[model samples]
Target: MTAAPHVPVNLADRLSRFSDLWSQKTVAGVNDYEVKIAKLKGEFVWHRHEDTDELFLVISGRLTIRLRDGDVVLEPGELFVVPRGAEHCPVADEETAILLLEPAGTLNTGDAGGPLTKAAEPLD
Candidate 1:
């Protein structure tokens, strides 16, 4: 089915539909990329997307993108882009909401597939 024309997707309402950490829900699409939202907590695996960069925008709480060189910390309303092929891990001390922009079907775990790897599901 197609979405209704001219009706904007509400991010907060979409986010409220789920509470599972580390699982991404597709909110919208931009060409070949998907705009996804996820609730994150604790530490994630070190992984790298060899072909596409990943953009992370924090909507609530704080997130730290840990890299080999250093860590990039982001607060609410902040964002960071992890360059392609760069090994990085995401860590959040508490529950954090984030929006991600990446190629459609990109695995959450990237090259380091594990139990945390989740396929993006469209928001209901």
Candidate 2:
């Protein structure tokens, strides 16, 4: 038997070209779900996606997801999903690398925080 061909992804490779707070890099796409890597810092504006919900998995560092009433702190091995139409904010104490899975066109942030919230698009 033979193993599947694969490429190694180093942290430097994934994050070297991306430094923007919400800058994203497309890793892979399988059907309706898209996998992406994002570099996050500071605090993200509170918002929500009107359509499909969002999924997040931390690769390194720590992340905090703030909801309308409370927030959840996520470590490197944890995951979180914010339901559609629910306002939330993502904040990081330090630079954090995270993998996200969501339907195409799903915004990284949400709509509740006014104009700063961004609509989903290619990072590079």
Residue 106 in model 1: lDDT: 98
- lDDT, candidate 1, 10-38, per-residue tens: 88888898999999999888898999999
Cα RMSD of all models vs. native, in order, equals 1.0, 4.6
Clashes of 2: 3
Residue 72 shift from truth in candidate 2, angstroms: 0.5
Q: Name the regions of candidate 2 deviating beyond 4 angstroms.
A: 1-12, 112-124
Q: Which 10-residue window of candidate 1 scores lowest in summed lDDT?
A: 1-10
User: Going through the candidates in order, what is the number of backbone clashes in each?
Assistant: 0, 3
By TM-score, how accurate is candidate 1?
0.96
For model 2, residues 2-106, the per-residue Cα lDDT tens digits are: 112575445457667667777666666668777778889899887778887788899889999999889899999899998888888899999999988888666
**What lDDT does the true structure give each of the candidates?**
0.93, 0.76
